[model samples]
Target: MDLSTVTATLASKSYDKVADICDNLMLQVATDGIGYHDDWPYAIHLLSHFYVNDINSARFLWKSIPSSIKENKPEVTAVWRIGQKLWLRDYAGVHEAIRGFDWSQELQGFVAAFSELYTKEMFQLLLSAYSTISIADAALFLGMNEDDATSYVQQQGWTVDSASRMLTVKKQPVVTEQKLDPSKLQRLTEYVFHLEH
Candidate 1:
């Protein structure tokens, strides 16, 4: 069967069904005798299994990857590392591990493909998010009354206050208008006239 068929069957199958298929495919592709002509399809199939959380199937595919082709196949390695880091709860490490690597050059352009899905705001949110910036704390930092913290949190986005080590990163942008406030403008003019005297 083709790679798509294998993927569909594996995805539709129960965990046990997938495990069995993976076991057979592993044997067929892991052998040194078959060239890429025979092995690439199975490799793609094995990697797809991981999409459904079949870590073992993914592990088999990873182990079967030839060292000789690792450089040329940076994407396979990059995808595997991305999965590994995510599975290991190394969120920060995931960014660092893939930072220097161009996703366009890696496996199926995984990062390049997914980067557009994340908005600029979402990316900034990830960058600003940390253990210290809890929603409640951010509201208070925004000059919100104690009782209004919850409301502010729901309505406004806040960042972690790095200096105070509190969730006080939320700042309201000061609104300015081309026409100055009439009262303030008059007061400023009077002050300037007094200074001239």
Candidate 2:
């Protein structure tokens, strides 16, 4: 597989295609060894997974990479650590891990791709920790503007008190279903059994 073509696809935001190519390339590497090339392809494969928010896949790829290669490329190791912290929702740790480091173009792209999703996760974490918080504070925590924060709260059906500048998060309603009629249950069971057989 041509790594440059894969990189171009990624740069064009063709994430699904990038994923497919990365999978095929990794399979080739596994079955046919690295050939005459180095392990940079593995790094690209990990980045593709990360770009699509497939943290588990990225972690699996990271583990599959040889420890010697990871040690030689500090950037790959750093990316792995950042990915781990991101998966664990350790926002502070993630920030600390990447601080003062000059990221490569590929690493920068991965971070940029995940930025919005990471902000959303951070917002969820903040909301879980605080039932009621000022909109400004929430916006700061979420790395969003005040208007965006208000819109986000509204989207979740949470109440925002403009006068108090506070957001009130009502618990989501639990949906309970009425018991099925005996005849309906019997019909469903028969249908399922017929499909299984």
Candidate 3:
């Protein structure tokens, strides 16, 4: 397991690549089938799981980590706290855990990247799920101050009705691809053959 490569990947903020490297290296070199060895870059590996919004994978990784290692490394546990909060969809708690932890210099960038990605996904979800939402609720869901959330929604083209204090979401049109049905295609071909004959 090359710790330096994982460190470099973290600095690059390519979490998917980091995850692939970590998982592949763990499988090849990890002793005793534990998938983790001494000096493993577990924090980033764990964060990489969440970065892809794979909560189940993150939970599995947490379960695989040995109790002794987690006990010794407070950073691992602290980072896992963010995952737990995310599993429960506790946005406030997620932000709190991220801000509350004293992340190492190496991890600060990765954590910041995760925060930005998560916020973006949450904002999209809000836009799709709501026609109108209160600024206070948006702030809570986005982990932003009310004023910032107001400005952010406005920038996204959501109309702000000052008297109502509700941000009307500018929902993007859903464009579903039209998948051709095989049976219909077969019938059309048969009809065409008959007509030609």
Candidate topping lDDT = 3
- For each candidate, what TM-score against the reference? 0.39, 0.60, 0.82
Estimate the lDDT of model 1: 0.49
Better of 2 and 3 by lDDT: 3
TM-score order of candidates, top first: 3, 2, 1
lDDT of 1 by residue, 1-197 (tens): 22454555534533334445655655665474544533354333434454445667577666776775555666557667755754674544444545546644213433432322222323345336543465444332333343454454434564444455444444546687778789999999999999999
lDDT of 2 by residue, 36-100 (tens): 23545665566567666688888887877877888788777777777887798766566565553
Candidate 2 backbone collisions, by pair: none
Pairs with backbone N, CA or C atoms under 3 Å apart (clashes), candidate 1: 75-106, 75-107
True-structure RMSD, every candidate: 18.8, 6.4, 4.0
Error of 3 at 173 (Å): 3.6
Off by over 4 Å in 3: 31-36, 174-197
